[model samples]
Target: MTEFDAATAIGEGGTAELSDGWVIGEAVNGGILMSLATRAAAEALGAAGSHTDPVAFSTTFLAAAQPGPARVESQILRTGRSFSTAEVTISQGETATLRHTATFADLDANSEPVHLQEAPPELPDPESCAPAARGGFAEKIRILDRLDMRIDPATVGWAVGQPANDGEMRAWIRFADGREPDVLSLPFFLDALPPVTFTFGALGWAPTIAFSGHVRSRPAPGWLRMRITTRNVIGGLFEEDAVIWDSRDRVVAQSRQLAGVRMPSAPVSP
Candidate 1:
C-alpha cells in the first residue's frame, strides 16, 4: 500500500492508528486527520455496495488529536441510486476529536456542461516563484517539510512586515513525495496553505473550528494552484475561503473554514 493508504488504513471495527510522522508540533495536522475520516467514510460506502465517490465533506474539530490509535465510526445516513450520505466520527479512547459528514455520488460523464466562471487567478509560474521561507514556527513543526509549496512573491509582503491591504495568499502546492492528487488527498491540500491571517498581521497559529469543502470533479495530475482569502476578522475569529484548481485549470475543490485567531500571548484551548 502507498504511504497515504497506510496512514489512513482502517482495521477491524473501523479502528486506525495515526502515525507520528504525520504530526506537527503537538497534534497531527487537521487535514491529515480529516483525510483519514474521509477515507473511512468512503470505505464504509463501498462495503455497502455503493460505488459513489465523495463529492462533499465537512468536519468540525472538537479536540486536538495526538499521534496514536483512534477509532473511526461511520454510519450511512442515507443511500439512493444516485447519491449517498455518511457521518464519521474520529475518536481516541472515548473522546471525539473530529466529526465529519460526507456526500458521495457517481459523476455523470454524458451530462451537459456549462461554464459560468472565468479563468483562475493569474500568478507567476511555479518555477519562477521561490519556495515559502521556513521560519521559527516551521522549525518547531516538522510536518511542513512534507509539502512542496511555492508562494507568489507579491502575496508574501507580510513576512517582511508589510501587511497586505486585503488578506489574500496564492501558492502552488503538492506533496513533497510527489503523490498525485486524489479525492482523499484533496482535504490535505485545502488545509495545507499558510493561514490567510498571516497576510493581515496575525502570525500565530489559526486553529480551525469548522471546515467545509466540495469536490467539483476529479483532479488532473500535477501541482495544484490555490488561493486563500480572509474577508473579516472580528473578536479573535475569522473565516477563510479557498479555491483549488488543478493543472488543467479546472476547479477541483473549494473550501471555507472558521478558525480562532491565536496570538503568541493568547492562551490556547486543549
Candidate 2:
C-alpha cells in the first residue's frame, strides 16, 4: 500500500494513525483528515450495499491536527434507495479535531447527462510547469515530498516575490509514490494545493474554517489538472473555489473553502 493508503486505512473500530508525512506546517493537512473520515464512512456503508461511493463531503476543522494516533467515528444518518448520508468525526483521544458529513451513492449507476458544465482550464504540459511547493511556502509545507505538483509558470509569481494579486492558481498534480487518482483520493486532491491567497502574498497561517467538496465522477487515470480561484477577499476572510480535471479532461471534482486570512500589507508611511 502507498503511504496515503496506509495513513488513510482504519482498522477494527475506526482507529487510525495520522502520519507526520502529510503535515502542511505544524498541523496535518485538512484534506488528509477528510480522507480518513471518508474512508471510515465508506467502510460503514460496506460492500453489501450499492450506496458505496461518496458523492459529496463537508468537514469543519475545529482545531489543527498533529501527527499521532487519532480515532475515527462514523454514524449512518440515513440510507435510501438513491442516496445515503453519514457523519464522521476524527478526534485525538477525547478531543475532537474535525467533524465531517457526506452523501454516498453508486457512481456507476449515474449516467445522467450534464445540463451545464465548465470546460477544463487550459494549461501547459505537466513537465513544463514549476513544482508547486517551492520558495517561501515550500519551507512550511512538508507534504510536497509525497506529491508531484507542478504549477503553471504564469501563476507562480507569488513564489518569486512578484505575487499577481489576482487570487488564482493552476497546477498539475499527482502522487510522488505513483498511486493513481481514484474516488478515495479525490478529497485529498481537492484540498492538496497551495492556498489561492498565496497569489496576494498572504501566506501567513491561513486556517480553513470549513470545506466542502463534490465528486462529480470517477477520474480517468493520469496526471490531474487543477485550477483554483477566488473572487473576493474582504474583512480578513477569503473564499477559494477549486476544480479538478482528470486525464481525459473531465471535471471530476469541485470544492469551495472559507478561511481566515491576512491580506497583503500596504506601504507604511516613513
Candidate 3:
C-alpha cells in the first residue's frame, strides 16, 4: 500500500511544487489537486500568524492537470483574529489548472451539539458490497489503486448497461494504506467517488466546472461512508451533492459540484 503525501515546502513568494501520484483518466484527480492548493493556502495562513483549519473551500477548475510537477501560488486575502481567507492557484508552466479560495477558523470544541438532520442513507454492510470494478476505466485512472472502495451493488447497474431509476450512489471508502482521515483528506474523499451522472445512465466523463466542500469535523479511524446524489441533469450540465458520514455515523463533510455532462464516446484503446 502506498500512502498519499500532500506535503509541500513553503517557498519564496508563497509557491510550492505538487508531487504526483493521484491521477484519473487523462488528468489528475480534482480532489487531490484541491488538497494541494488547500495545503498551500494553509501554509500561507500559518506564515501570516493565523493558525486555523479550512472550514469552507471553494474551487473552480479552469483546465485539467496532468501528472508530474505543478506549482501552487497562494495569496492571503484577509486575516482576522478568528478567521482567515486565502486564494490558491495551481499552474503548469504557463497554463493555469485550478483556482481555489478557502476560509479558515478554529472550531470551538466545547460548543454544544445540536441535531436536526435525519440519518444517512441506509445500505448493506461494507463487507457485503462488491468492490468497484477496476478494469479499463480503473486502469486509465491510476488513483483507484490508492483507494479501498466497496460500492453498493444496487447502485452499479450502470456498469452493466442498466440505468438506475434514481441517480444515487452509496459506497464505503478508505485509503488503501489505512491511514486515519483528517481535515486535509476530507476534500479528497468527497470527490473520490465516480460522478453521480453515471447512475443516471449518462456515460462518458462528467467534468466538474466548480466544486465546494465544507469540513465539519475530522473523521474517526475507519471507512468513510458516502452518499452521492444528483437531482437534475439538463442542458449538458448537472449538479451533484455528496454527504460523507464517518465511522461513528456522524456527518463529517458535505460537498456539491457543477459539472458538464459529456455524451458517451467510443472506448479508447489503452
Candidate 4:
C-alpha cells in the first residue's frame, strides 16, 4: 500500500475539516466528511497505512453539519498489537458537526472460514437509469449527474457526478485534475442520501449519528456500480443498507448507517 494525502483536512485547532469538494443536501455529506475525519485521526496517531502495511477503518457520524469550511481533531483511544482505536470530532465554524470513533488494524493471516453472504440485485444497465445534470461538488452536493439513478426503478449502477466508490451506488466520479483511481486514491462515495428518504414520507431529514464498517475486501478501479435501499424508518431514526459491485459483477465492500430524524427539517415518528 502507498501513502496518499488524506481526503479529509486537518483542523487549525487540531480538528479535521470538510473538503471543499464535499456537498450534500443543504449541507455537505456528513458521513463522508466524518469518514475523512477518522482517517485524520488514524494519521495523527501514526496508525495510517504505509507502503507495506494496510489498515482497516470503522467510523461513526455523530451530527449533521452545515456546508462551510470545517475542521476535525482526534484522540488516540488505545493501541493494541493487532488494532488501534481513535476518536474524532468535526466542526463547522464553532458548532460541533460530528463525532467519530474509528479502529485501524494491520492485516494478518488467519485460518478462519470465509463466507460470501450477499449479492447485488439484477438491475438495468447503468445507461438505462435517468441521468442527473448537476454540476461540480459545490453547486449540487446530493444531485448526481454522472451515471443514471433510478430510485423507483431501482437497480444496481453508478451515480455519476457523485462520489465514486465500488459499492451499491455506481457514481460517475472524475478524479481531481491529474489523479487516477487506485487503492490509495480517496474514493468519494456518498454514504448517505437524506432527501430521498425524507421524500418517502417515512421520515424527513435526519442527521447521521454514526457510521461503521468492517473492511472485508478491497476494490479495483474504473467505473463501479452501487445499490442502496432504505429498509426501515421509525422512532425518528432511519437505516440504509447497501451493496457495492464492480463491472464484472464482483462484490466489493459493504456498508451500513443509522441516522436520527430531528423533525420538520427531519420527520416526526408519530
- Predicted structure with the largest lDDT when compared to the true one: 2
lDDT of each: 0.83, 0.86, 0.81, 0.48
Worst ten in a row by lDDT for model 3 = 261-270
Candidate 1 global TM-score: 0.92
What TM-score quantifies how close candidate 4 is to the native fold? Answer: 0.66
Global Cα lDDT for candidate 3 = 0.81
Q: Tens-digit lDDT track for model 3 on 1-270?
A: 236654334456655555445777778889988877887889889888894588889999999987666778888999987778999999888999989999888745511284554377788998899887888767776777888988899898988899674779999999887777877788888899888878766767778999999887667888889999987766778789999988888788899999998634532111
Model 1, span 142-260: residue lDDT tens: 56677789989989887889867477999999888878888788888899887898887777778999999987878889999999998767778889998999998888888999999
Candidate 3 pairs with clashing backbones = none
lDDT of 4 by residue, 1-270 (tens): 111244354545675444444555566665456446655666766744321112444455544666556676777777767667777777667777766666655433321234554665666654665444346532465424222234323322223223222222333332333233332222234353333343343233456565555443344555445555565666667665555555445554455677665433443233
Would you estimate the TM-scores of all the predictions?
Answer: 0.92, 0.95, 0.90, 0.66
**Global lDDT of model 4:** 0.48
Which model, 3 or 4, shows the larger TM-score?
Answer: 3
User: For candidate 2, lDDT tens digit of each residue in 121-237?
Assistant: 889888799876555757668788889999999998987799898888999999999999998899998888888988888767779999999999889889999999998787888
Instruction: Please give the distance, in angstroms, between residue 112's alpha carbon in candidate 2 and its true position after superposition.
Output: 3.7
Off by over 4 Å in 4: 1-7, 11-20, 47-63, 107-114, 133-152, 155-204, 247-250, 260-270
